[model samples]
Target: MRKSFFLVFLFMTLFVRTEAIRIVGSAPDYAGQRLEFFTVADPVSKTPVPFFEVTIDGRGNFTIEKQITQNTYCFADVGVYRGRMVLVPGKDVRITLPPLREKSFEESKNPYFNPVDIWLKVNEGNKKELTNLIARYDARFYQLTDTYFNQLYYRQMKNYLDTVRIRLEREFEKEEEPGYQTHRHLRMKSLEADLLRTGREKVAGSLQQLTPQEWTQPAFSDFLNRLFVNTLSTESKSAAGTRMKMWVARENLAELSKWTQDFTATEGSLSDLILLKMLHDAFYSGEFSSSAILRMVQSPWFSQNKEPRIREMAASVQKKLAFLQTGTPAPEICLPSSTGTIWCSGRNTKPFLYLLFADLEIPVCREQVRYLKTMAEKTGSKVEFLIVLSPSQKVNNTEFMSSNQIPGIMVTDTPNRKTGKEYKVRSYPSAFLLDGQHRVVLAPARTPLDGFEFQYTDLKK
Candidate 1:
C-alpha cells in the first residue's frame, strides 16, 4: 500500500511543477495606443487560438504566458503596425517596439510627402538616391492602385493618372541620381512608351530625344511589353490567358478553347480554375447582367466541388452577381445590441432594406448618416435601415444611433467578426441594400448617396 501511494505522489508532483514559457514586451507611447496579442498553434493552421489575451501593466509592459506543448506563434498589433514573435517551450522571450507615429490625412496635403519622406528615410539622406527610389516605388504603387481603380472607378483614375504623369515629368527634370544620363535615357523611353499608348501627340518633342541604347535594356523592354499587354487586355476583356491567349489568338481560337476546356475538365485545383473563371467573366461578359452572371456561377462546374477557398470565391461571386434575384430570400442578420438584441430579416419589411456599417470616428460615415436621415424622410418608412457596429470599435453604438437620429435597428457583432465576413466588409462605411426577400440587392454601396446628391427617385426608379 505504501509503495503504491509513493508512486501516485511522484506523478502528482511532476504534474504540479509543469510551467509554460512566458513572453514579455514593452510598448512606447505614440499617439493613441493599445497592444493586441494573438497566437497560432502551428504555422500551418490559419485559425488563431481563441480566448487568449495579453495582459498589459499600467507602465506599458505586457506579459503573455502559455503552457506551450508544441510550436507556438505570437504577434503584437498596435494600431496599423504589426510585429511577429515566436516562442517554444523552455525559452525566455522579450520584445521591444519602436515608437510609431500615427498616420494622418493632413500629411497627404503635401504633394511630395510620400516621395520625399521615403527619399529622406530610406535613401540615407542622398538626394539622388531618394529621387530614384521614389520614382520606382511610386510607379509600382500607382500601377497597382490604377489596375484596381480601372475596374471600380475608371474615369476618376484616368484623371489621377494624368496628374501623376505631369508630376513625374516635373520631378524627373530635377532628379540628379548617379548615371543621370543613362537613367534619363531609360526614363524618357518609358515615358514615351506610355505617352504613345495614350495616343497623345503633346509629348512628341520629348519622345524625339531618346537614345537607341535607352530602348534596348531588357528591363525597359520587359516593362514596355507588360504595359502593352495589360493595356490590350483591359481594352479587350475577351482576352483570357495572358501569354497563352495572345499565342492562341495568333494561332487558332478553337484549338486554344478546346485545350482550356480539357485542362479545366481534369480539375487539378478548383480554386485556380475559379479564379480563372472570374477573370473570364470579367473580360468576356460584355455588361453586368444579374441573370447572365448568376447562370454562369450556378453552373454544375462550380457546384461540383467543395473546398474552403473555392467556397469562399463562389460565395463572393454569387454575392456580387445574384445578390437580389427574384425568389431568393435575403440573408438573416442577428446580432447583439446595447438594449438587448436586434435582428434584421427581409420578411415583414417593406420591399427594401438598407444596412450600414459605420465607424463613428470616420468623417465619411458621419456625412453618410446625414444623407441616410434625408433618405429616411423622403422614403417615409418605406425602407428599413439597419446599422451594425464593429466589435473592436469603442464608440457607443447606442449613443451614436440616437444622436444621429438613425431610424433603423442598431446591432453589434461582439467578439466575432461573423457579420463582417458574411457581408465581406473589409473597410468601414460599407453599406448594402437588400430586397424584401432578404436577398442582397445592391452590395458594395461604397459611394455615399449624399456625395452623389442621390435623390429618392434614384432608388425608386
Candidate 2:
C-alpha cells in the first residue's frame, strides 16, 4: 500500500512539472503563407532560452506551447514582424496577431532601416518583455553585423561570418520552401553584404559569386543596400561628404521633394509634416529660392485641405519674417514675475524688451547678468532689459535681489508657475524680446546673449 502511494505521488508531480503555457492564433487567411517562430536571447545577457512557435496548418490554425519558468520573458518573431511577451509557467496565454498587411509589413525605403519606429512600437506595450526582447535582438544583430563586418578591428571577421552563415543555413533547412524562403534569403544576403564590406577579400568574393536572381529579390536588395549604406556612412572616411553626395545622387530626391511640397501645401499630419520639414531643411536650406517656396505653397498637398492650425502657422511665420525685417509688434507675453506681477505694456520708451529668465547657480546666468548690466548702460533708451529668476529651492529671493542688484521689479508667480511653461523656458538664461506695444518683437532666443541685437529695418509690404 505504501509503494502504491509513492507511485501515485510521483505521477502527480510529473504532470504538474509538464504543464505548459499555450499561445494559439490563426493568421488572417493563412491559406498560402506559413508562420515561422523563434526566440532570441534576453537582450542584455545574450542567453539562449526555449520559445514557442507554430506554423499554420492548411486550416489556418496555429498553436504553440512552451514550458516556461515563472516570470521569464521571450520574443516572438514572424517573418518581418516581431513581438515580445512574458510567460508565467503553468498558465496558458493566448495572443492573436493580425494579418501581415502590406501597410503593416512595409519596410522604409530609406537607406536606413529607421529602427526608431520599430523600437517605439515594441516599447509601447509590455515594457519589461519588450526591453528584454530589444536587448536580445540588438545584441544578436550587432554580433552578426558588427563583429563580422567592422573593418576597424583586425580580428577574424571570417570566423564570425562563417558561424552566422551556418546558423542561417540551418534555419533555412527547417523552414518550408518558397514561403519563408524569401525572408531567409534576404536575411542571409544582408549578413553576406555586411561580411563583404568588412575589408576581407574572401568574404567579398563569396558575396560577388551570388547569382543574378539572388541579387534581384526585393527583400535581398533592400536589406543588402540598407546594411551597406548604414555601415559605410557610419565608418567611412569623410562620412558627411559621402552621405551628402549619396543623398544628392539618390533617384528618390525628386519624389521626396515633391512629397515635401505636397505635404507642406496641404498641411498634413504633424509627424509627416515634421519629417518633410527636416528633409527640406537638410537638402534645400540656403539653396531654395523664394520661387521654390511659392511653388511648395501651391502644391496639391497644401492646397487640397486648408487646416486652420496650418494657416495660423504660415501666418505666424510671415509675421516672424516681418519682425525680422522691420521690427513688427510680436505676440503679447503677460506672465507674472519675481517681485510683483509685471506686464510688458509695449508702451515703454524703449523699442525692445530683453526678457531673461535665469537660474543663479549657472555660470552662464552670471555672465548674462553682467551682459544685461552692460546693455542697460549702453542701450538704455533702445532696449528695456528685464531679468527674472526661475524660482528654485537653492535660491533665496532676498539674497538674489541684493547680490544681483536687479534694477527691474523682481517678481515670482510661485504657486501657479505659469510663466516658465508659457515662455517654454527649457533652459536657463532663455530670452525673448517685445516691441513698444508689449508685442513679441523677436524670435525665441536660445544662444548666448552676446552679439545678439535686433534692428528691424526692412519690412516687406
Candidate 3:
C-alpha cells in the first residue's frame, strides 16, 4: 500500500512539473491589448494553436502560465510583429517586446500580411536560457547566410557550407535537449539541401529514420514542408510519378503505403505525413482529380488510423480540399450586424451575393468599400453584399456604414477572426461571389477597382 501511494505521489509531482510553463513579460507599447502565444500543431497547414493569452495591464506588464508537455517553438502575435521563442519545460521565461509598429493600410488589408518575426528579448536575468540560445544561433546563422549568400546558394561552395556547419556546431555544442538537437539537425539539413540542390527524394531519405518524437519538433515538420512544396508538379514528370498517379486514382491506401515505403523506411506516421503533404499539394496542383483526392482523404482508413496526428491532419486537409475549391459550398457565417441584428450567410434574397472580408479602418479596404457601394447602388439588389470586418478595426460599424451608405449586411467577425479563418481570408478586402445556394462562384472575385464589373457582367448575362 505504501509503495502504491509513493508511485501515485511521484506521478502527481511529475504531472505538475511537466504540464505548465510560465511567461511573464512587458510590452509598454501594447498595454491594455491582448497578446496571444501559439505553437504550430501541424506544419503542413501551419495552423497555430493558441496555448496562452494575457491582457497587458496599463503598466505594460503581463503573465502567462499554461500547460505544455514539452519544449516547443512558440510565437507571440501582436499588431504587426510575431515574436518567436523556444519554450522549455519547467523553465520560467521573462521577455520584453519591441515597440509597437502598427501595420500600414496596405499591410492591414493584405490577406498575406507577413509579420516581422523578431526574436523576443529574454530578460537579463534569463539571458542564459534555451530560448536565448536558440535566438543567438538563429542570428549567427542568418549572418553567415548573408555573408556567403552568393557562394553557398549560387556557386554551391562546399567550403563555405562546411564553415557554416562547423561554426554552428561549435557554438551550440553540448546542448542535450532532444528538441534543440532536432532543431540543429533539421536546420543544417535544410542548408545542405539548398547548397547541393539535392533532389527531394535524397533529402527526404533521412525522414524514415526520425522517431515519432522527433517529428513533433516544429523544425522537422517545417523542413519537411519545404522539401515537399509543389511535389506533385515535379514528380508528375517522372516515370515513378505515373505509378503514384495510378495509386491515387484508384484511392488505394494500401498501394499508396507501398509506394511511400520506397521513400520512407516504413509504412508509419512519417510516411503518412509525406503522403498527406502530397495529397494537399496535388489537390492544388491541378494534376489530380479533386474529387478523387477528397474521397481518398475522407476514406474510412483515416478515421481508423492509429496515429492521432495523422487523423487530425487528414481532417484539416480534408476541410481545405472540400471548401477551398472554387465550386464548393462556403462555410456559413453568422455575425451581428452594425444595426445589432444578427446577419447570417446563405440566406441572401438576391440571385447572387458578394461576400467580402475587409477592415473599414484600412485605406485599401475603405477604397474598396467605396467602389463596392457605387457598384451595389448601380446593381440595386441584383447582387447582395455581405462584408465581414475584423474586431481589431476600432470603428463604429453602424456609423461607418450609415455615413458611407454601404449596402447589404455588415458584420464584425469575432476577435479571433473565426469567420475569416473559415473562409481562409488571408488578406484585407477579400471578396467572393456566391450563388443563391451559397456555393462559391468566383473565389477571390476581382476587386471593384480591378474591373470586377467585367466578371460580374459575364456571370449575370
Candidate 4:
C-alpha cells in the first residue's frame, strides 16, 4: 500500500496541473482564412512572432491552445483584421472582433490599423467611461487645434487633459487588472505626449517622468519616437521646414547615428530601445536603403550595446538589401491564379520579366495594368508581365483579367508574406525587371509610365 501511494504521489508531482491558454474565436465575415497568433518576440523590439496559427473553419470557428508560463499579449491577425488579448496562463479567452472598414484618409500602408481597430473595441467593452472621455477628447482636438497658435487654445486643452488624468488616477487606485492598468497608463501617456508635441510646455514634466516599465511598452515607445521627431521638427521651423530639410540633406547617416547614440545614452536599457525602434520603423517604412541600414549596424553604439534582437534585425535588413540588388538572381516563387492555375518562373521561357507586387485597393496598381496593356499592344515585346498579390487582399484574377483586359498572368500569394519577403516587395505597385536567366535587371525596375517599355526592350536583348 505504501509503494502504491508513492507511485500516485510521484505522478501528481510530475504532472501537477500544467498551465496553458485556450482561445476560441469567430470572424464570420472572414471565413476560409487563418487566425495567426503572435507574441512580442522581444519586448524592446516589439516584433510580432508567429506563436500559433489556425484556419477559421467554413463555419468561421477557430481555436488555439498554447502552454504558457506568464501573462502575455496574444495578438491575432487575419487578412486585414487584427485583435489582441492579454492572456494569463490557464485562462480561456473568447474573442469577438468588430470590422473596421474605416475609410482611409490617405494613401497609407500602416499595418497598425487592424490592431488599433480591435484595441478600440476592447476599450469600449472593458473601460467604457475612459473610452467615452477619450472619444470627446479626440473629437475636440481637431475642433480646437485649428486655433493652435492662440494661448487660449492651450489653456482649454490643458484643462481637458487634467480631467482625463484625474479620472485615470482615480481608476488606477481602484483597478486591479494589470493589463487594463497598463492600457490606462499608456493611454494617459499618449495624451500627454500629444500635448507636449503641440507646444504645450505645461505638461512637459509629465512626459519626462515615465518609469522604466512604461518605456518598454510599444505604445509608450511609439509616443516617445513621435515626441522626439515632432519636437525636433517644430524646433527647426526656422525657414518653415525648409531649414530642417536642408539640415537633413546635409547630414544624412550622421543624423541617424547621432539620434541612436543620444537616445541610447539617455536612460536605462533605452540605448537598445531607441535604436531598435528606429531600425524597426525603417524596416517597415519601405524606404530602407543599404547605406542607411549599414550605418545603423556599424555604429559605435551597436557594438557597445550588443542586443540579440537588434543584431538579428540589422542582419535581416542587410541580407534583404543585398539580396534585391541589381544583377542578383531573383528568388523564384510558385503561386496559383484565382482560376486555380499554378504559375511560376520555372515554367516561363520569356526572355524578360515585368514583375509586379500589387494590391487591389491601390489605385496605382490598376493604373500600371493599363500601361502594361498599352505596352503589350506594341509589336515584338518578348516579355512576360506577372502581377502577384497577397491573398489577404481581395483580388479576383479572372475578374481582373476580364475587366482590364490585362494580358499578363495573375497569381495569389499566401499571407505568410514569404513571397513578398523574398521579392523585397515592401509596398503596393512595386515593380521589378528581370532578364531571361532569372537575374535581377532592376529590383525596383520601373513603373509603366516611367517608360518601362524602353527598359523592357533593352532587357530583352
- What do the candidate models score in CA lDDT, each in turn? 0.50, 0.46, 0.77, 0.58
After superposing candidate 3, which stretches have Cα over 4 Å from the reference?
1-18, 123-128, 157-160, 197-200, 239-244, 252-256, 263-267, 324-330, 346-353, 360-384, 389-400, 403-406, 413-418, 433-461
Ranking by lDDT: 3, 4, 1, 2
What lDDT, from 0 to 1, does candidate 2 have?
0.46
* Model 3: per-residue Cα lDDT at residue 95: 82
What count of clashes does model 4 give?
Answer: 1
If scored against the real structure, what TM-score would every candidate get? 0.44, 0.40, 0.81, 0.62
Residue 160, model 1: lDDT of 47
For model 1, the superposed segments whose C-alpha errors exceed 4 Å read 1-77, 82-232, 235-332, 335-348, 362-364, 371-373, 389-406, 411-430, 444-461
Q: Alpha-carbon error at 109 in model 1, in Å? A: 15
lDDT of 4 by residue, 1-461 (tens): 99999999999868665587676777676577776677665443445577888778898887878877555555665434456555556666666666634335342354324334243233334433333333333444434444342432355456666765665466446655554455556556556556643443233234344544344345554455544433333434555556434433443544554544553334334444454455544444443443444555545555445555455544544454456667778888689876787888756688877788776656777787767788777624678888787564455646776787877888877856668756756676778878788888887877777777787667548
Q: Model 2 compared with the native: what TM-score?
A: 0.40
The per-prediction CA RMSD against the true structure, in angstroms, equals 15.2, 20.0, 4.6, 8.3
lDDT of 3 at 333: 82
Clashes of each: 4, 18, 5, 1
